[model samples]
Target: MNAEKPPGSKQALVIIGMHRSGTSATTGALRCLGVDLGNRLYKGHEGINDKGYFEHSDLADANDEALSALGSSWDDILLRQENWWKREELIPFAARIRSHIRKDFANSSIWAVKDPRVCRLLPWWLEIFDSERISPRFIFVIRSPHAVFRSLERRDGFSMEKSFLLWSLHYLEAEQWSRNFPRAFVDFDRFIEHPAQELARVEETLGISFPISVENAAPCLNQFLSRDLRHHQERESPESSPVLSLTHALHQSLLGAVDSGQPDSLEMDALWNKMESIQSGFPRALVEHIRSSGSIQGNLQITMNRLMRSWSWYTGKPVRFLERLAGRNV
Candidate 1:
């Protein structure tokens, strides 16, 4: 088989998926294995992530700002123009973004950068990082559209129409990219349901092994990991958390569809369960706030609240972005 990557900058992993698709948790899981996670890590973000975000702060912010300059935002960037890549002005501008990511992550081996925005800019990455020096192991996180639209509507107050559009665009781009590379599709729901096993599938695809100490990183998994370490792990039942079961059921539904050899339904269900499972971790109060917020505007507001918190963790600016947007330029 013809190889797309060359010998030796080490085979690095790149996580591609929409936002709220368990990218952070997966990054943490991989760190638990043996990967080098650059020079810094973002602290836990509020509203969405209770733990933290690990993507590069500036890179994310730059992408956000660029979208804003086009009079739309990330939520709506995909639908605005299919020809953003063809913009002559953006070529050199994007090249700089590529150079920066490479320089910042130069020291790491078998590194992975997980950000949904990166998927949209694949052509740019392919242009800049096409060299054989960097062997990229692509990992795509697949989640469900129903859950994604629901979550986007819930978290961002997006209109069902808007959420559906975004959900479809995001996953379609992800699916298309998956076809072009040596990639692994991770069921977000399953990864959370059986993190170790799901992660092992990714590890095997990348030809790597996770470290034995990953269990020590999260206390919630103590009982789960202690039970089996091999096949299935036992999990605690929480009285206040029936949502976990809903998430898991969604996973089984999707897995069963795949087992039945229905590729189309399997793919669709996989995306839905993954998104739903990740959101199941949110506090009950947050879920209610989303439900009551009603539609696209409400959901966007809620998601932005959480997103601000995550960006804060990534950049160590408690209210930097907020202040800057407020004209304070902090």
Candidate 2:
């Protein structure tokens, strides 16, 4: 796999992160910098992210279908297959994305692709980018797991533990898979606090330029990253459990890399290995805990159904078991 860019290939700014971790805001900033997003987009609404997603809905839907083909969706982090990217089902979706890149952005010098699903789908996308001959520079958005959980809690009604676990698993895979790419981590909290400082650093690292400086794009940035756009900020810093400790460790390491303008993989590699070894037990434990009480079960059943449908593929459990578990108290 020659990862080098082809002579006439375009530059692709691949914006990735777990859902609600500010990928939207970061991509919106890219738009403010004169990067072409796409013709069709899923515009943000009053209740959701009013700043707009800056994402291609067709591509997002393709990602969802591809994940479903693999028995996992964006939120079903634990249920994804080991080495899933190599599966035959992803080829069609990869072709779709690659074709979009070739046709949609053919004239573009650089364009941005913003989708949380891209974090998990990087292996397929890396190959796609290579095949398309486009050079991809990644921006991994980071946010406090607790704060993200609060956002998910209000919006999706996800349990705190599930959200934290998703944060750990999602980024662990994203960082590991994107290790070889030209990439930079951006702390969304701080990025919103001071866009100019963070983006200046990001531009310096990627050898890519955003047409307008963050300072120059002040009015656009202000409108996109409004005070209300940032809804949650986790103040408590205690690591209450081994898993939370690991989550915090990943969060800190990402921010530390941002702080120092250096990317480190050794620590993240260890965290990924740990998460993999223990995650099979994690789903069972979380499910049993959710089932232990009848009240929480009712509150979580719909969300659990949405996430659990395809998880059976990963745990070697029958699909019926998860179906029953999701449908009933036991």
For each candidate, the alpha-carbon lDDT, in order, equals 0.54, 0.75
RMSD of each: 10.8, 9.6
Q: Superposing every Cα of model 2 onto the true structure, what RMSD results?
A: 9.6
Each model's TM-score, in the order given? 0.61, 0.81
lDDT of 2 by residue, 200-278 (tens): 8888888897777767887887777765667887866554866777788888888897777655767877887777776
TM-score of 2: 0.81
Off by over 4 Å in 2: 1-8, 237-239, 282-330
Q: Candidate 1's residue-wise lDDT over 1-330, tens digit each?
A: 122444445556777766666677677667666665565444564555656667765555555444433443456522324555556645555666667657766766566666676665555444445543566667766566445545566677765445444545455454444444556667666676677666666666657644444445445343323212112122333333233434345444434532342225456545545544545566878655543443354345445646765745558675777887789955
- Model 1 lDDT on a 0 to 1 scale: 0.54
Best by lDDT: 2
